[model samples]
Target: MADEHRNEHAAPHHITPLTTYIFVFVARAAGTLLTWFASTVDLGWMNTPIALVIATTKAALVILTWVVVIGSFVWLGVLFVLTFADYLTRFWAIY
Candidate 1:
């Protein structure tokens, strides 16, 4: 029974809108490369914003790709909200 179920589900269940996935991968890869490039530059104030943007983009891609809980859209929404809140709070002095 377990083997039967496995066989049924193992047939390459791909997500739709393949373009979106491609874009996500490209953005994440670009962000990673930018982060690496930024590390070698001595821009002082500019570094924080660059790093934050890269980190936020990478985090978003990860959440979208791997953390989609089954029947738990609310949780995903909350995670997104929290992630955005963190991103916003990082670059500025928030009271």
Candidate 2:
């Protein structure tokens, strides 16, 4: 009876296949290389946007692979708010 109860309350184990891990690893490595390459190229006004997109993509991959989806979204929401707040304040010196 105790064993049965323990099993019932235990969280299910999710086993990520080796191929999934390998795929993520390769993707992250590619992202790293892209970032390095991006730094060397001067794209004028487009540089920051391009780098941000690549970085965000890399971050999303890691979050999706290792974090619970809902939790990651919540965290991302908080970060977005904080970043927006900082951006909004950046122009304060001009005022």
Candidate 3:
């Protein structure tokens, strides 16, 4: 029985090609460049979200796994919610 499940633990995975790695690296580099460009141009309320999206994409590429992708979105959502939550509390006067 253990041997039957052994293959499940050590399942054969797809091997990644060098060119595929190079492409992902290029994509990550492009994401960084786009982030810089976005920073330079003021997009008003649109800047943070766009930057977060680019950063998350780059982060996802670092591992290129579904777990990383899901985690990235969760991370993004946390940051976005916290930022807006703080933004929403900037006007209190109860001293």
Q: What lDDT does candidate 1 reach at residue 6?
A: 69
Model 1 lDDT tens row, 17-64: 878778888988888889999999999899999899889879878677
Query: In candidate 2, which residue pairs get closer than 3 Å at backbone N, Cα or C atoms, i.e. clash?
Result: none
Tens digits of lDDT, candidate 3, 1-95: 65664655575767677887788889988999999999999999999999999997887776563344677779878999999998888776753
Best by TM-score: 2
Q: After superposition, how far is residue 71 of candidate 3 from its true place, in Å?
A: 10
Number of the predicted model whose lDDT against the real structure is largest: 2
Selected candidate, larger lDDT, 1 vs 2: 2
Give lDDT: candidate 3, residue 10. 71
lDDT of the candidates, in the order given: 0.80, 0.88, 0.82
Model 3 regions lying over 4 Å from their true place: 1-10, 63-95
Model 1, which residues run further than 4 Å from truth? 1-15, 62-95
lDDT of 2 by residue, 1-95 (tens): 65655767678889888998899999989998999999999999989999999998988887888788897789889999999999977878776
